[model samples]
Target: MTNILFVCTGNTCRSPMAQAIMQHRSEWNVQSAGIFAGEGADASQGTKEVLHAKGIPFLHQSQPVTDSLLEWADLVLTMTQNHRDLLKQQYQAATNKIYALKEYIDPDYEQAWTELKEAYAQLEDQKLVGKEMQADVIRKINKLEKKVQNVDISDPFGGNIMTYQKTYEELDNYLAQLVKKMENENR
Candidate 1:
């Protein structure tokens, strides 16, 4: 199973919502963390209310992101680009598998995947390609990657209950879509 790690600032808000949503929804193994060390983090009342409204079970434990979690994750999905940047800079070795959660939910996934496959094949071609051609191909693939990237999900950390509920809805929706994609890929 693919192991997914969702991250946010405090773990009380965004990351917990994502963790709960993805854990129950996706076929993949899902976990969550906060950039800051949350020693006594419990789910906020707003968070709890929203989850209870949706009938999502709550398991409370607040842990800061650790090297072990980074190493264990197959993919790390941050709530925002800033969070991704922070994680990448701190854990450069794991940058290869990190992304923003909404970043992968693009409408042009098929086209983007096709281009990525072609780029990988070019890199592996038995016949040697000239250095310039290889560089050009690499640049093109990177551009395509940006085009298909998911937009960073917003943080509703200090917002009211309505805001938390809205955020929960968005998280749940995207996670359900992710689960569907995983199922199709496995089939």
Candidate 2:
């Protein structure tokens, strides 16, 4: 069984919701934690409500991301590119297995994402030399931005139930794609 770990800024919202959704849909071992979570905090009410509406039961206690948890997961899927980068920086050994959830499931986004990163780095380097960003670089960045627009899942931490529901729907859709990809790989 593949062990998947979902991560976000706080365990109260996105990560736990993803854990619930994935667990309900697959037999794979699933768990979640946050990069800056306070231990034992309950999942947010909006998260709880949305999961209940979707008929996916979940109980969660917030916990900080730990090395042991990272070690346990076969895949470490973060809710945002920033979250994925943070883990990669701090836990270099796990970098190979870490990915932002959308980027992991959607291979079409991968090339654009790599090129975007390179473009951004080039832009930064030009700035260091006190040169203005070239028009071509700017255009490439803008195009890549559109292609990777959905790379990060929306954070619904303080939103109302409707906002939470929207986030849930977004996560559910990507997760369905994730399941299909994994199943096909196994086959």
Candidate 3:
């Protein structure tokens, strides 16, 4: 089975929602992790409620991203550009396999990549640290954000239930298209 990993900032929401929704398809081996998940964390109430709305029952304990997970994942889909950037920096070996979830689903993914990369290259450097790191990273992220935000699935942590619902519906729409495209390609 193809191993697919979904990642986000916290495992309590986006990635778990993706995992649960995709698990229903029975096509690939799917798992989810967070870049900075606290140990033994449960899925947020918003996530559970959203999944339940679509008749998906998901019980997940949050886990942090690991080398093992990087190795196992055939394709890694991240929730946002920030998550993608972290994965690329931390797991350079898996750079070829990592993509933003929207990047994977969007028709103009390559153009988006090109534009984002060009903007990133125009930025001073990739590795900024200490106090300067915050400003530099924000600048770099902001540049790419303008070109790709139209396709990005927004993070809904700590928002109202409606916010969570919007996030879930967007994810579900893209995921449905993703599964369809994968099936067609495989066939």
| Residue range 49-78, candidate 3, lDDT tens digits | 888887888889999999999999999999
Error of 3 at 129 (Å): 40
Worst 10 residues of 3 by lDDT: 120-129
RMSD of each: 6.7, 3.9, 7.6
Instruction: Mark the regions of model 1 whose C-alpha exceeds 4 Å error after superposition.
Output: 107-150
Off by over 4 Å in 2: 114-138
Cα lDDT computed for each candidate against the true fold:
0.82, 0.93, 0.85
Number of backbone collisions per candidate, in order? 2, 0, 0
Q: In terms of TM-score, how similar is model 1 to the real structure?
A: 0.75
| Candidate 3 wrong stretches, greater than 4 Å | 112-145, 149-151
Per-residue lDDT of candidate 2, residues 152-175 (tens digit): 999998999999999999999999
Model 1 pairs whose backbones collide: 102-150, 103-150
Query: Distance (Å) between predicted and true CA of 106, model 1?
Result: 1.5
lDDT of 2 at 102: 91
